[model samples]
Target: MSLMDYTDQWLSVVQPQISQGSSWLADLRQGAVEQFATQGLPHARLENWKYTDVKALAKREFVLPKNAATQADALVAETSLALDGIRLVFVNGLFSAAHSQLDALPKGANVLPLADNANVAKTLLGQVAAANFSGFTALNLAAWQDGVVIDLAANTVVEMPIYLQFVSTEHTDACLIQPRILIKAGVYAQATVVEHFAGAEEAANFTNVVTEVDLADGAQITHYKLQQESVHQYHIASLHVQQQRDSRFTSHNICLGGKLARQDIQVELNAEGAEVNLNGLYLGNGRQHLDNHTLVNHNAPHTNSNEDYKGILNDRSRGVFNGRVVVHKNAQKIEAHQSNGNLLLSDKAEIDTKPELEIYADDVKCSHGSTTGQLDENALFALRSRGLDEAMARGLLTLAFANEVIDRIEIPAVHDRIELAVAGRLPEKFNLKGLV
Candidate 1:
């Protein structure tokens, strides 16, 4: 059957859950599905998807996760790593109210499921996301199960952080899941949020995610994403952040999972004096692959943006990084910098780094740099001479190479968690011993 036939069947499976469906949303989904039908998954011929193959995803037969016959208490009890704030939980791409905890929300903080909040989800759904996202994204918009909506009131500062944990289970075999999240920060508001994606085991699964963030004037937001899934799974995520005047937005993406994964992130500075920082790290081993494509747009004058992404490739794995910074003609005095650096451990492993800068404004300052190579032999030699084993020496150097980007993360707890996760991925490379 064609891809649209599968989407239609998928919609029929979830038809019972459509509660008070907005007419506009229904029509939007219908159109998006039709668009998806006309054009199947983008092939290598497509400019944007020239590297990754979407046909591999189109060949799979995926089913929606049935309702949990298992007790939810088992799921809630497993979330033992307690953080100091509200928590939203989703299982198999379905939001679980019974599993969420919101006891410490401040006076003006509002948290609700996006699917239930139809009007709000519709207002924000396709508004800021990439218009021509991949086929998986189109499928997500056409038949998304549930999402999260977070709204912070003006002049309010949420003392505690908000944690979002998405768990993928129930599909013992191959399946597809999509989770969507929309966040709005009112004027003069401040908040921090953490999003984590994890899988149950090494199963053939796919996660297609889209997140939209809107920040008003003078607002500040710090957002981080942690990805760790089974090696047999695949993950694709897109994050679109829009900032108003005098707003500060800091975002970090940590990728440490999936057999074949790709992330597309974009940040737009819409008003004057807005500042943004984007940082990312991806660790790959075995035969896995990780790709990150990011774009930063300076639309107004006096806006600043800085970005740095690092990757460590080992074994036979491969990694790709593409970062772009654009300065509009009207955006005078805009300053932007972007850099991508990668370290390859094995001769068989490969990495491609491309940092691009496009400027239309005469008064803007922008630069981009990219580098791909192996670990420094001089540093490894120094460490090995100090009574360290070959594997230990390589691990130390790899850790230090990745630590430069990790140190940029301002949050202590989040930084620590990411560092520990990266450390777990490295092992001693015997081949580099004498060369180092």
Candidate 2:
């Protein structure tokens, strides 16, 4: 129970309600509670948290909820996963503005609601995530309870897609839902941001989130993440990106629910002709535990990066993918690619895939790969000679191997709500996408 008594019972109940109106946000929340009492919670003796273990979720007994004990069905369990632009609602972690809708914001867009604009992100808020980046980003910058301060202006183009909905309920005590998101994209601006995390199915809540994105020069950003909470919730998230020159960043991560889910994606292209794309998909059945950790740093010089991640596991579920790509040193003519693929379909399902490439540039074009198999026993007996049974031929080849990361989701209602939440986490869900 010690990380200095979990940072003194989390700053004696979140420092008098969100560090009272800024003194540089009370020194950035007391320097992230003294760096979570000097790097404490993040177990598996950390090698990038070696195969994800949170030591029984850092020995439970947690708290830091500062009001949001809401639940008269929490607006029918968060509008059954609603989506239709510019919507921001957070039930368990404050900020609801009666289930928000910001009147289609524009005209010098600055999507506030970080409880009084969080001092307008005092110089890019913690300058792209570094309050000792871990131990849950120092307990989400030491206990955050509300967020969303996106300031895009330069050549502002919003065209919808700013939805951050986080809802959790049923907490008798053992709460912790931290949300801190700050996005700043100006020069040549364009945006898309969607993050949906749900809970309340016997909510054993704990969602620690941190998102910081700043891309200026030639700016363009698209990030979508959906982590379906409450398999007995506990989800950890982190996405930190900083890019420049010709900047363009894209990421789509869909990890269905969590008994224990982890996502840490860090991208730094720096300048030159920055470009980054990362697409991921993780689905697991009972005994669920999904982990995805990605790091891409080209550091300039005609930089371009692309990564793809996919995983599908059934019962006895376990999946982890660690993808890394580094091309620094002059970064000469850089181009990096990484891929991790897994499909285990229960033979006591399990996957621990890793794809890494570190090239100290020499006119670089780096590549990384990892693959795990199952299905395709001659295309599942050729779809059982075309009559299509055998659980609809392994759910149409596991939804065509998860439609290769859901056919690069280009927002058709966030791609049919991620193809019906990855076909309702397939365990033979019939008409999986209704006969395609």
Candidate 3:
């Protein structure tokens, strides 16, 4: 059957439980479901999904939660990822204040659920909750129960990092979860936020997530996303960012989960002297697949951006990276660079890297490059001669290859934690001595 048929079938299956959401949101969800049914999942024929096949992943039917009270302990327990920082917890896409802690927040920083602060956040939330996004986003807008909203007052510098976590625990059946997040950084403010998406068990599940970030003039915000889900599940995520004049923004995405995962990140520079850095890494094995698509827009003069993304594919896994930079006609003196590198550990594995540059300005400097190849034999032999075994040598070289992307991260603690997680995903027998 076609993808549209599959979407209709699943929507019909969940139609009975649509009323479980808040009564005020029931109509919105219904409208979103209808839009999703009409739009369906993007396929290889679509321009945006040409390299990634999302139709196959959309064939399965996921049960919606019966209520919000189930799996309360799991959500509360997982909220400790940020011990000294503000924390927001979402369980199966339902916000839980009881499990969240924000008492240590800075004087001017505010952390609250979108549904709770509905009066103030509702305006911006509605403005950003656009329906023109992908089918997954449309579905999320319709059914998302509640999500975290953060606001930083002018000139406030939040010392402790804020962490937001979306934890999914399979109850007695397979299910789907949708999460939405909104962040606003005031003028001249500075802060960092980390988002982690995880599943408690390996089960048939799906998660659709959307995040929006707005930074005013001279504001600086660093954002990171870590994706680790059940191997049998599907994950689709999109992040949109807007920067005002002289502001700075950076986003780091780490993908290490799901049978099929796709992420799209976009950043728009609206003022002169605006700067941005986009970095990402993905690891895949078995028959897993991961894809990253990033776009950087230079709409104003004197804006600058740098992007680097890498992936390591072992076994029969596949990886894809598409990085695009666009400089408008009036965006003179813009400096932009992009690069994508990949290592295929096995002949059966595949990596597709594409870098595109579209510049309409005469005085702009833009460049992009991509490379895909196997492990270096010379380095492998050198490590083996130094008494390291084959797996150990391979692991060391792999970690070092990913280190180039890791070095771009500014936070020390986060850098270390991400490195450790990536190392653990390598071959079990592999060892590391001089790799660090």
TM-score per candidate = 0.90, 0.34, 0.90
What is the C-alpha lDDT profile of model 3 across 1-436, one tens digit per residue? 6677777776775576455455545666677788888887776788778889876777766777545535567644653353466777777776766777788887888878775664555545534445556777776766665677888889989887788877777666667776678888999999888888876755456788888888889999999888877677788998888888889988889898888999988888989989999989999988889989898889999999999899999889999898989999899999999988998877898988888899999998888898886578999999899998889888888898898888777777778867877787776767653355
Q: Extract clashing residue pairs from model 1.
A: 391-428
lDDT (Cα) of model 1: 0.78
Worst 10 residues of 3 by lDDT: 74-83
Using lDDT as the measure, the top candidate is: 2
Which residue pairs collide, candidate 3?
none
Task: For candidate 2, give the lDDT.
Answer: 0.81
Q: For candidate 3, report its TM-score.
A: 0.90
For each of the candidates, the C-alpha root-mean-square deviation to the true structure, in angstroms, is 3.6, 20.2, 2.9
Colliding pairs, model 2: none
In model 3, the Cα lDDT at residue 85 comes to: 61
lDDT of each: 0.78, 0.81, 0.79
For candidate 2, the clash count comes to 0
Q: What is candidate 2's lDDT per residue for 1-436, written digit by digit as tens? A: 5334455555565565556557887777777877877776766767888888886776676676656634524543453455665888787777877677888977767897786787777777778988787877876786686788899989998988888887777778857888889999999999898888876778787888889999999999999988888788889999999999998999999998889999999999899998999999999889989999989888888989999999998889898999888888998998888888888877998988878788887997777778787777998998889888878788888878888888888877767767877886787554665654
Candidate 1 per-residue lDDT, tens place, 1-436, comes to 4444455554554344432268998887766666556655666676666667655565666766655524445644553235656888877677777777888888888877777786866667777775456665666677677778888889878877788887776365565677778888899899888888875654467788888898999999888888877777888888889999999998888898998888988889999999999889999999888989898899999999999899999898889888888899889999998888888888888887778888999998887888886678988889889988877777777888888888887667767767776787775453333332
Error (Å) of candidate 1 at residue 245 is 0.9
